[model samples]
Target: MTLTTDTPYALSAPPASLSEPLEGSLKVDIALVGAGFSGAIAALMLARRGVSVALIEAAEVGHGGSGRNHGQCIPVFGYLDEKTLPPEGFVLLRDSGRKVFKTIEELGIACEPVQKGWLNAAHDAAGLERARAAHAKYAGLGKAGAFLGPDEVEALSGVRGYLGGWVHRDGGHLNPLAYVRGLAGAAQAAGAALHVRTPLTAISRQGGRWLLKTPRGDISARAVGLTVNAYGDAAIPPRLRRSLVPMRSYAIASAPLKPDQRRAVLPGGVNFSDTRRDPMFFRVDESGRIITGGLVELRRGRLGGPTVAQAGRRLARLYPELEGLGFTHHWSGMVGISARQRPAIFEINEGLWALAGYSGRGVPTTMALGRALAATLVDRAEGARLWPHDAPGRIPAAALIGFGVQSLRGPLNKLRDRV
Candidate 1:
């Protein structure tokens, strides 16, 4: 398989048909743009229902944020308790996330997923209070795991920086690329025509069917679903554009640590993150490698990722026991954040739809949204209910404001230390 932007990341190359140059215009019952989890799952659902689907990609599948993200399967609804979220929004997010997680387990995709849950560590006195308050709000939701005090958090995380933590047993981790590509393979098996290296230049309705103009070829279908969240280079529905803002973060992996060291770092090999607007998230890999990530506003503009030393230094600050650990790899990717910091799924036109903006929580959300979108397409009577159509809004100038925000993160951290 030759991987293209239209395919998933786990496949180094795209499946045969998609890798080759498209000869001429083609036609299908449904045309999909973007090949990440959402698009891939949508394709699979439609194809399984006997819809002839064509999927177009601008780059190799999973190359975007889908493949480049921290592989945490967190479905705990962190945004639910945040001040930015509306009361009804919190309930919706939590319920929706729960449904998504259940669906993945039911499907049995086997992407090495674990439903152990997440640890939201409080790094300060104020953070501890917030953690307790967060627990009160979600207690009625009846999630798994216990909210711990400072001492308990230290015992679990093996780090002293945390004052306390909230543990949601329903959250977990997995190999993101593998899970996304699995959906692609399933879609192919369902009879969808997958096209890679074919970027959609224009999408418009003609004679009732949606016609998508691509660099290599064109696909005409009765309906279209645009899933390109961050790479919104095409003229998309105005609301989607306004709903998502692309922000970058950096991650680094350390060489697999010896058993003792790994145990000393993360006792249960659990994934954890602090309670910062711009947070530092990390977890131990299957190989026992400690993977750590943080908001690296400093390198937002420059091309390469943060050095191992930079990541190491941050790790040392949080987990001083690993001050001497050596890192193995470093990378960075974009995350689509909505102005309201929530995921949205809605129809743009009569048959055209979109599902994007997971904020930093894409894995489970995308999985859930993709399958929901697929179900909606199969039964239009339920489309509006599944993913209600809302007015499209404009994304503020995130790139510009993001640059400034990133630049200030380091200074802000320093100031907090002094206080």
Candidate 2:
């Protein structure tokens, strides 16, 4: 089958459609836009707390980048450091995968979450040093983190040419589309009304509450949470999209490998991503297929163009079994880049918030911070906490800068590997 943009290989099957569009005016304590991972979790948490909440989505649940990724459940952030994130936020980030998996078990979400291990491998001297330092930081957080030698990496993962790396046993992979759908369902059951195919066209303070305009009807709520992110370009305000530098993260999946072929790569059940500017990451999914890819476009644009040929070439570099392997699917999703390269809850206005810009680490990070955002919505705390809120700032000439970044990625990787 040919690769597609609308229907990714990870969510090839038709997802059960969510609730219909808003048909009449409604009032709630809190209104959330975007039914992806962030909004779903936030809505779920607020609902459980007995807060009247409504989750509104432009499309069905997980119809955005949430469903289209390679589905790796990475716990730690590469770009986000302790100094960058708050102490409470650091704890949440460190135990991210465990928290996500715990919720999956408690809520009985059928996302197929697995926990073998997740590795951050290094390719050269600089990368080796970074990995060692990262391992020490991870070790300080938990005992599940362990460093591996070059030979050990080669043995655990059938991939060669790696110096050393760190692995966290709690991190693994999951079916993100299903996870989002499950969370939406749980949130609905908990009394959070979920409205799908409901795009927010306008929002302004009406009286004491915020009035959100939709295609079919209008909604008035005391507070609003925007989790639209990259997919929010058309669904949300133009200014919201401008605040984020849009980028596409692409992935290609090889034809389901034979049992023996699958066993050869990532045999230790660890997902592997190298230490390069333009990194190559791969993992064996439950279907026995090797899924991997990370190539942003030359500009802030789309997820539906064409899969890069480079993805297939890099896949073959890791496992000999995948050499000359036919790719069964190719897909891409847009990820929003923030100013700080960390997760932030942007305070767009009084009682109007936007939570986004996870870069490419949305799967694990969203769940941890989503809960924090929910708490802040209910309790107006005076001090800093797990979910840090900031004023929204637009990236000047984001498209031009994004183009320059993508163009330099390849050369930067080559030069860095040499050093």
Candidate 3:
């Protein structure tokens, strides 16, 4: 058991690893590492196309950030066209991402999928104006989004502290784990072999084929896809690893609230995010429990781990109607983020490809990337339109700079609350 990358967060609770390494060298048309949405969807699509596929997971399916994190299925790409992205580039990203949400409905993978959309609430006048600016951009592109004022925001969200916001009509919410598992199950049903808990020790290409050395043994494949997002094990290039900085995010699910409390918080049950750089994003589950999350506490350090009662208390402060509601579950997990705040898809080598860096908008974005990568592999089809090619390049100082920026996020968030 030689060590590899020092990725924190062990398998919190395990049902046992479902994987055994390659006892004998086996060959396949494509090998996908990671059983999350991106890898699973691509594996399923390729296998269905009669391509031999092998799906590998370092841990159990959905054990990483995929299964963790808040289950908001909102479809807005996190990046904007301001200083970070060009106008044409944002149009491409926004339009393509819009199509990705459309595909989810077409696939019918059902995980309580909703398309009623969400709001990006403004905490101040300046934020409200920015929301309007975003609204204009989406409107120019003919996307079904617009600005809403304080009255409309209050009417919709039932929250007190909001100046206005933008509404994305096509965005929605879903169960993250269930959808990920569905993708994995689809791949298996389509004749792909899945190996879980078989951590890859190293990967190297030989004879135009990639060899994945795992704990149990080795497997060879003509092509490979790396879908492990934030939990960067050293199995990949340092450059690619630097593209995504892992950050710990926390969430708390309260015990089923009384009917009135539920009505008070999530009036119409539309998902919601805020203008805060590290905004508190939350929604009510079907079980009538409030699921809320935000930036990591300054005292909690960078690696978000087992949460404490303090998180629940903070949640209570935001929506005081639910004070003393008694939180049933509290936990945290890491999410992969790109400095450009957009996802990237690139060819790593001759036949090896990588698709990751969703910047915390992993739900719909993952589905979108999965379909595009699958199409790119199967027949050089056009699903590559899911993400624009000329998107912003990685910021050189992204790794260390991101850490420094996020380190101050907690305190800055506290300041925003006062504003």
Candidate 4:
């Protein structure tokens, strides 16, 4: 099955050619399934350490969530209480965003990365309080964050209704597809073999190695890492599949804004998303057009038409100046949501690993997780310091609960917006 869907990023970026699909049996120290940011970054890291790595993808690189997200790269676990995070997880989340930026710079990946910062605007008094508390928590940890009152929020966002918000100075945005493609190139250059259009049909262990069977051939490796995220299929273990709920996320891109409109909206070119349960995020793209996205409910295995219309309406409400503006593109993709609403790292089998459930914070977090996983595979001592040794277990009926919550959240979010 074709995994890639037509999206603005796929049309704009130059096509990348990593390599042909696997045609015969190949042996490597590690075989990474999925060519999204996580798999590609892990491949690059491992290859740089002189490990034989084979990175395989079912479709073109970044064809999944990596290429279709809103592109905001902020710290993770934003909606969750800080006290619940494990010490190692806390450290990883705190440093992941910076690690992504540093890696991009050091690798010279031209992904149009912008470090202006991310603004978490508050839609109501309660939202403002939550933002303030989050800011205080980050501040207590020596992270640079600021609470912007109504006036400051309006000045920064050019939107009038926000009561207040918090700004994470270290957070930013980038062109995700370009970043993933660049990772593919970097990994291949570092001596890792990248096989595109190669889907793993099944995997089994034999003779202390993993045999990943593809349509054209098989790959033998000491270890396997699955980074397919929401696009995971029956090929993955049932435990991993049951641990995530895939939700459709919809986005729209407006025609390039006129000079006056650009000056009045997001003048500093910062990205912003509200603190709503089902939030809306907007950022000024490279072409000066407003790119916005929000959660949408799926019916009959597709995002309902009204859900897309609601997104456009939400955009207009936030920026009345751009009301009735022409949209250049509309697209949707699936994101993996965990039961606990946090990212999940699972060791599916003794030598097999997987990471998913970014919960809409995949950009920076995925790369960071990939690096940690690679470090662990390359050198246990070095990797253990960056990631926890305990792997996450399956969450019972997570998919059903997640879907039900999302289904209920849609109308409630619309009502909240009206209020």
Candidate that scores best on TM-score: 2
Q: Rank candidates by TM-score, best first.
A: 2, 4, 1, 3
Deviation (Å) of 315 in candidate 3: 5.1
Displacement of residue 215 (Cα, Å) in model 1 is 3.5
In order of appearance, the predictions have TM-scores of: 0.83, 0.91, 0.82, 0.90
- For residues 15-42, write the lDDT of model 4, one tens digit per residue: 6754898999999999999999889989
Q: Tell me how far the alpha carbon of residue 283 in candidate 2 is from the true structure, in angstroms, after superposition.
A: 1.1
| Candidate 3 structure quality by residue, lDDT tens digits, 1-419 | 12112211122222332445456566888888888878887897888789999988988788777777677766565464545644544454555445545655655555555556688889877777777777776666566555677787777778777888877775666666656666676688779988887787899989888999888777898878788887768887565676776666666666677977877875756788777655667777666766666545555433223333554565566677766666556566677776556777767667777777877777767766776677666544354444443332455665565566556877786686676
lDDT of 2: 0.77
Q: Write the per-residue lDDT of candidate 1 for residues 76-170, one digit (tens) a residue.
A: 65555535544534444566545555655765554666656678899777767877787766666786456787787887778885777887766
The C-alpha stretches of model 2 lying farther than 4 A from their native spots are 6-18, 78-84, 298-309
Which residue segments of model 4 deviate by more than 4 Å? 1-5, 78-89, 298-308, 379-382, 390-392, 396-398, 416-419
RMSD of 2: 2.8
After TM-score superposition, the amount by which residue 74's alpha carbon in candidate 4 deviates from its true location, in angstroms, is 1.9
